[model samples]
Target: MEWKLLATVFASVFIAEMADKTQLVTMLFAADRDVSRWTVFLGAAAALVLTSAIGVAAGAVLSEVINPRIMSLLAGSGFIVIGAWVLWQAIHGGA
Candidate 1:
């Protein structure tokens, strides 16, 4: 196991997930008086695990055909585009 890689991924994902929509949604679900907190936790955990699995599988496949550097560039550009779009929408009162 690549300990360093594992730690890096854990840190990155942990920081990114904190206070994000997924966490907020999970909190809302747990807040419902009828819902068991364990149930909410399990559901949220399963969803995150499934999505992470998909991401790992996709990355594995893509790394075979696409250069990592190019992928990084593309991801950076995508984030920039998304950030700009969100800023534009916010400035426009989210129409």
Candidate 2:
């Protein structure tokens, strides 16, 4: 197994998720009087795990059918496009 790769992914995702909406939603859930904090944590963790699993599985399948270089370019372009859209929306007060 690639320990370094695992660590890199974990760190990258952990940092990225620090201020993510999912974390904020989990916090909001935990703050409710009727909701248990541990339950919220567990539910959020499970959801993240499941989503991550799906991403990994999809990536594995894609890797088999697509060239990694092309995949990387596509992914990068997707992020750039999304970022630009968000920026445009923010500038236009479109939210």
Candidate 3:
């Protein structure tokens, strides 16, 4: 295993997940008095693992068909377009 690649991916994902909806939802679950903290941790961790697995599988299959450069461009463009749309909505008061 490439330690550098592992560290890069781990750091990227850790930062990206910070304060995201998943974290928020996990917090909510943990806040509930009746729920076990262990259950919340396990459930949230399993869900994240499952989603990451899906992403890796999808990327593996897509790489067989699409060039990595094109994929990166498309992903970056998609994020830009999404950000712009959200900004436009905010400026327009969602009207």
lDDT of each: 0.97, 0.94, 0.97
Q: What's the TM-score of every candidate structure?
A: 0.87, 0.87, 0.92
Clashes of each: 0, 0, 0
Worst 10 residues of 3 by lDDT: 86-95
Name the regions of candidate 1 deviating beyond 4 angstroms.
none
lDDT digits (tens) for residues 1-91 of candidate 3 = 9999999999999999999999999999999999999999999999999999999999999999999999999999999999999999999
Write model 1 residue lDDT over 1-95, tens digit each, in one string: 99999999999999999999999999999999998999999999999999999999999999999998999999999999999999999999994
User: Which TM-score value belongs to model 2?
Assistant: 0.87
lDDT of 2 by residue, 1-95 (tens): 99999999999899989988998988889889997888998999999999999999999999999998999999999999999999999999999
lDDT of prediction 1: 0.97
Model 3 RMSD vs true structure? 1.4
